[model samples]
Target: MNPEDLQKLVTMTMPYGKHQGRLLADLPGNYLNWFAREGFPNGELGKLLALMHEIDHNGLSDLLKPLRGRGR
Candidate 1:
């Protein structure tokens, strides 16, 4: 995915729940894993989270480090 899309995923706030206002990318791995087990939510946000999960799972979070550093 493009950096802008990834940035939006990383910085977007959760609309609800205990982790509300937290960045999607910053959500704990266990939490995301739980979602994977239980199934992700519906719509674009869910898609983004699933994508983030894959990225994080592959240990390529560093690929986004530059974008994060750029403050996008």
Candidate 2:
């Protein structure tokens, strides 16, 4: 994914849900999987969630560690 998207994963908070206010990068794989099964929300949040799902699915979540706190 692009740098801004990666950065957002670590900085942007989930706007709503049980995980509201949680970092997108820190969301559990199971939660992302739930999205995969249930379908992600619309717009930018959905895009980020889908990206995170792929990262978590492939066990590459750590790739985002260095980008934390640098999001726009």
Candidate 3:
């Protein structure tokens, strides 16, 4: 979607839940799917989760590779 959103995937940590502390980009597909089915959280976290879900769902996760270590 936007550059900031994509960057947040790599740089931001999940603020809560089983995946807390994990990079949003690295969240498991199944986990993302659960959010897809159950509805993602509200606001920016939800948006990013939804975006990551799409990326993971469509197998476009590789696109995130180039941006991954950039945040580290």
Candidate 4:
């Protein structure tokens, strides 16, 4: 993934869904896993979700902490 994508994960909110307005990095693993089990949407949001899924799945969510701090 690109460096900007890592940044985006911490900054961008989910545009739609039950998690609407929730930061991508903050989405629960189950939600991300749901996408993995089902299918991700099309476009950049899809890509970001997939990436976030990987991050959550691999237990690397903590890696986004600094990036989340930077957004403040």
Error of 4 at 6 (Å): 0.5
lDDT computed for candidate 3: 0.93
Could you say which candidate leads in lDDT? 3
Q: Write the per-residue lDDT of candidate 3 for residues 3-64, one digit (tens) a residue.
A: 98999999999999998999999999999999999999999999999999999999999988
User: CA shift at 30, candidate 2, in angstroms?
Assistant: 0.7
Tell me which residue pairs clash in candidate 3: none
Superposition-based RMSD of candidate 2 using all C-alpha atoms, in angstroms? 1.2
Superposed on all Cα atoms, the candidates' RMSDs to the truth, in angstroms, are 1.9, 1.2, 1.0, 1.1
The lDDT-based order of candidates, best leading, equals 3, 4, 2, 1
How far residue 69's Cα lies from its native spot in candidate 2, in Å, is 2.6
Specify the poorest-scoring 10-residue window by lDDT in model 3: 63-72
Candidates' C-alpha lDDT: 0.78, 0.91, 0.93, 0.91
Mark the regions of model 1 whose C-alpha exceeds 4 Å error after superposition: 69-72
> Which 10-residue window of candidate 2 scores lowest in summed lDDT?
63-72
Question: Which pairs in model 2 have colliding backbones?
Answer: none
Give one digit per residue, the lDDT tens place, for model 1 in 2-71. 6677887656877787888888878778888888999999998888889888988888777766665445
Model 4 residue 63 lDDT score? 86
Best by TM-score: 3
Can you write out model 2's per-residue Cα lDDT over 1-72, one digit (the tens) per residue?
688888888988899889999999999999999999999999999999999999999989889878875635
